[model samples]
Target: MTDTRTDTRASAREILRTLVGRDDADFHEGQFEAISTLVDDRRRALVVQRTGWGKSAVYFVATLLLRRQGAGPTILVSPLLALMRDQVAAAARAGVRAVSINSSNAHEWAGVLEQLRRDEVDVLLVSPERLNNPSFRDEQLPALISRVGLLVVDEAHCISDWGHDFRPDYRRLRDLIATMPAGVPVLATTATANSRVVTDVAEQLAPAAAASASASAAGQPAGPGVVTIRGPLARASLRLGVLRLPDSRARLAWLLSHIDELPGSGIIYTLTVSAAEDTARLLREAGHAVRAYTGQTDTAEREESEGMLKRNEVKALVATSALGMGFDKPDLGFVLHLGAPSSPVAYYQQVGRAGRATENADVLLLPGIEDEAIWQYFATSSMPSEHKAEAVLGALGDAGGRPLSTPALEARVDLKRSPLELLLKVLDVDGAVRRVTGGWVSTGQPWVYDQVRYERIAAARLAEQQSMIDYERTTGCRMEFLQRALDDDTAVPCGRCDNCTAAWYPSDVAVAAASAAAASLDRVGVELEPRAQWPTGVASLGVDVRGNIPVGERLAAGRALARLTDLGWGGPLRDLFAVQAADAAASAAMTSACVRVLADWNWEERPAAVISMPSRRHPLLVASVARALSEAGRLPWLGSLDLVGGGPDGSSGGNSAYRLAAVWNRFEVGAELAAALAPFAGKPVLLVDDLADSRWTLTVAGRLLRRAGTSAVLPFTLALRS
Candidate 1:
């Protein structure tokens, strides 16, 4: 046994040298132990260690050792494309031939499959979402599972519903684990799992016997047991701080004044896409090299941005949480947040991106007053209501094996596209629905909507939010507060935070810089890209629309004074449209801003007339803006379009098809408006509204005006909903 242990150590050392290209390198604390549990004992294990703790090294080393012993290849379930790319490269360095199957590389799947069949691949990296692919799940996955030597679930915290970044697709791993052959070791690893998430994940990774018993009760197969090894969550290299700014302008001023003082290329995280883009624009205009990274960034652009940041070509990537998790940069020098995240676990995870291999890194949070509102939006968006889930299941059941595309399903249900997609994923995980080649179909299985479970999750989320608020207010060690929120029992004052020591950062913003930032943020006009295609299956709703909308009927690219998510005007606009806020005329400041936006708008042709969308709630506000614009621009004020049938009580807010259907025939050009528009034939007309949410109202109203002899319709609104 001694000889065998010595030999194992030697082999691990060799693998480690190959992995890092350094002959003197060795495994970090607990890494070899985790490897031994997988390789020698053939037992499942969970490693909850800080970032850069050699978690990937453990799995790669184990894969190499197991392969040498003639075990089959390791299958790694990764969460992000960026992560998969990095893992593949890292595996290659260790002489482990790795191949990935993800959305971005569909064309290479054939070659990857060929390599897998030939046993030339040592490891295969795939996204958790790939587990639900019909063809792969039914055909490839079973064979791979039968022959696989080990399974690695990277970012394992995502498997838990209690995790900050819970994904329904990750839960589907239970089915795969339950069906795996006994004695095959499985490794689950993450850097961000707190005690609760760890416990939840461990329960899911319970021994095959327990899993079998539970599966038997649930009428499924058993899974494997897991041994968890958790390490200290504290990062000694991070110097944490939180600066409370007066408002968005101050936040921008602080960044502009101090971003260059940051150590190296880092990330500036924002809460919304608009904020990310706006911040990036501001930084760039101020002569800082930055780019926006958000969900809206295309795949190629995202890869380019990642590469630039890695090469230190850009100062920062102003981004949303889209840049979070599995983005590997060993020497990332700093992480600054424009606003606080909703949970401390999440905040810790994001800040963990910094100081991985550095002596010291700065982690700062410029907390904003608007953060809670943004948090509330995301929090509610993620949790599906029972009624919505029931509606989805009912729609699928009524389809009776006929695949229903998401748009078709959207028409049948009241949920919007994003929430509907999330609900479908949850249902798919529960085995009540299946995604096939065309779309989604019912599996004809009875599934319970676990209201109690959902409620518990929601309550936990609220607690996390409260904890984040406390973290901002704490006068003690900020890092300790974060660690404690993660249930880290060893959490203590690090004496490296602003509260523990003195403020290491400059707190004052120069007057000129503050004014410039304020002006940049306050100057709002986001181009509203017109919808070119009508939503599919709207014909089924008796709307008689399909395919691309007629070119002439579509409004040209339009403009809005601001996005409801923008940093500057967003706050006041949100209040203006608040549910309890009493309706009133547009404020003088808002009207003047709208006029300035109109004057600055470089439309192809200046508007010869103006028209308003009849508003039931904000009629006075909408009318005042139109009248203001008409007078300032010296354009004729065509009357507001008459509501033919009550206008569906003002856009209950669902999918595009439903939103369009709600206002399909709800408006008409009255005799006076039609006559007014006829005189402006072949001339541009400004279509004004209080707000633009779905843009369906704009689309329908624009079509009506264009058909009434206007040359083109230019849409302008007080705000655009993000």
Candidate 2:
């Protein structure tokens, strides 16, 4: 056994040398241990180390050694597309032939499967969602599971509900590990798991221990045990600090004034897509070469931006968390956050992108007052509610084995598109439903909603948010505080952070630059792209809508003064729209801003009249904006569209089809309004509203006016709900 371990270590060193292109390259302290356990002992192992610690090296080296012994290809389940791309490139440098099967390269899957069949690929990297895909799960996964020599779970923390970014799809990995042949080694790795998450993941990695006490009850035999290896969670090259600015303008001013002084090219992180886009625009106007990256960005453009940042062609990428995890740049010099994340684990994961290969890197956080609200939004969205789950099950059961598409399911449920999809994924994992070629069908299996478990998870998330709040206000060492939060035993004062030493970042902002930033943010006008296709399954609700909306019935692409989540006016808008706040007319500043927006709008034919959508909650606000626009634009004040009945109340929140059904035919053109609109028969009319959320109300109302003899309708709102 000793000789075998020694041989494994020697081969690992050779592979490491090839991987880094240097003869003297060696393994980190815990890398060899993990490799030896997997290659020689053929045992399961969990490795929890810091970001830059060589976790990939362990898997690649183990794959090379195991393949030399005539084992089948190693199957690696990765979490992110960027991570898979980087790993494929890293494997090539080590002389290992690797291929990836993910959503981006569906066209290449046939060739990849052929390579796998021929044993031409050494490593096969795939996303976690692919495991549940109907064709792959039924036709390919079983054979691959039997033939795979080793299994690797990267970013394994996501498997645990205790993790900050827990993913339901990753929980499917537990079953996959259980079915592997005995003695086929398994390895799980992550950099951000706390003690609870680490324990949870380790149990999942070794199913035998999890089943040992309940084997008889479960009617299955125990499998194998696991070994855990954890390392210190400190990044020696990072210099951490926090800059608490009073508002968005100050934060933007600080970036404009100090971006050049930062060490090298890095990322500027934002909490929302609008913030990223707005910040990137303002920075470019101030003469910085930067780009915005978010989930909304095209895949090709995202890849190009990643390459530009890697090559140091751009100073920074104003990005959301979309750029986190698996992006590699050895010389990245700085990372700045425009707002704090909800948990230290997530924050550490983002900041870890910098200073991986450099001697020093700057890490700074600019906490926002609205951070908690953002956190609450995400937290509530992520948790699956019992009511939604029950609604989905009922819908599936009613289908009677007929597969139902997501849109069809959305029409039947009260949840929105995204939350419904997430709940469906969770149900798929729990075996209550199945995804077939057409869509999803009920399994007719009895499943219980674990209310106790879900409540516990919600409580844990709230605790983490409080911990994050404490992290920002802590006067102690910041790095040490983060390390302790992750339950790292070796955490200590780094003597490098701002708290440990003196202030390392500039706090003063240039007055002129700040004024410019304020001006840019204050300038509000966002284009609202019109919905071209009517939602599917609307006919099921007795509505005649189906397929593409007729061009004559559609509203023109419209405009909003700002998004309710915008960095500039979002705070005031949120306050004004709060449930507890009293309904009032629009403020003078808001009215002025709306008038300026109208003044700058370049219409093909100027609007001949202005009309308001009748509102129940904010009637004064909507009426005030409509009157102001009518006065400023010198257009006729067409009376507001009259509500037919009670109209849908504030409780209406659901998918597109349902939302449309709620408001369809709910408004009728009164005699006075019809007469007022007749004069504008051959010209455009500006339709004003207090807010635009699903846009279903606007679409239905716009169709009514267009049919009532208006030539065109242009929708405008005080704010948009993204």
Highest-TM-score candidate: 2
* Model 2 misplacement above 4 A: 163-166, 208-224
- How big is the positional error of residue 355 in model 1, measured in Å on the Cα after superposition? 0.8
**Candidate 1: C-alpha lDDT:** 0.88
Candidate 2 lDDT over 1-722, as tens digits, reads 89988888888899999999998999898889889888888988888888889899999999999999999999999988878888999999999999999999999999999999999999999988899898998998898988898999999988998642356889889989989998899999999888777767867877556434232111122345667778899999999999899988899999888999999999999999989999999999988999999989998899999999999999999999989887888789999999999989899999999999998999999999999999898887788888889999999999989999898898888788888888998898889999999999999999899888888888888888899888898999999999999988799999999999988999999998889888987987888877789888888887897999899999988899989889987778888888898889899999999988887888777888999998999998898999999998888888788887887784546888888888888898889998877777878899999888999899999999889888889999998887
Error of 2 at 107 (Å): 1.3
Query: After superposition on all CA atoms, what RMSD does each candidate show versus the true structure?
Result: 3.5, 3.2
Clashes of each: 5, 0
lDDT of 1 by residue, 423-473 (tens): 899988888899998899999889888888888888988899999999999
Model 1 ranges with Cα > 4 A deviation: 164-166, 207-224
* Candidate lDDT (C-alpha), each: 0.88, 0.88
Worst 10 residues of 2 by lDDT: 213-222
* CA displacement after TM-score superposition, residue 168 of candidate 1 (Å): 0.8
In angstroms, the error of model 1 at 718 is: 0.7
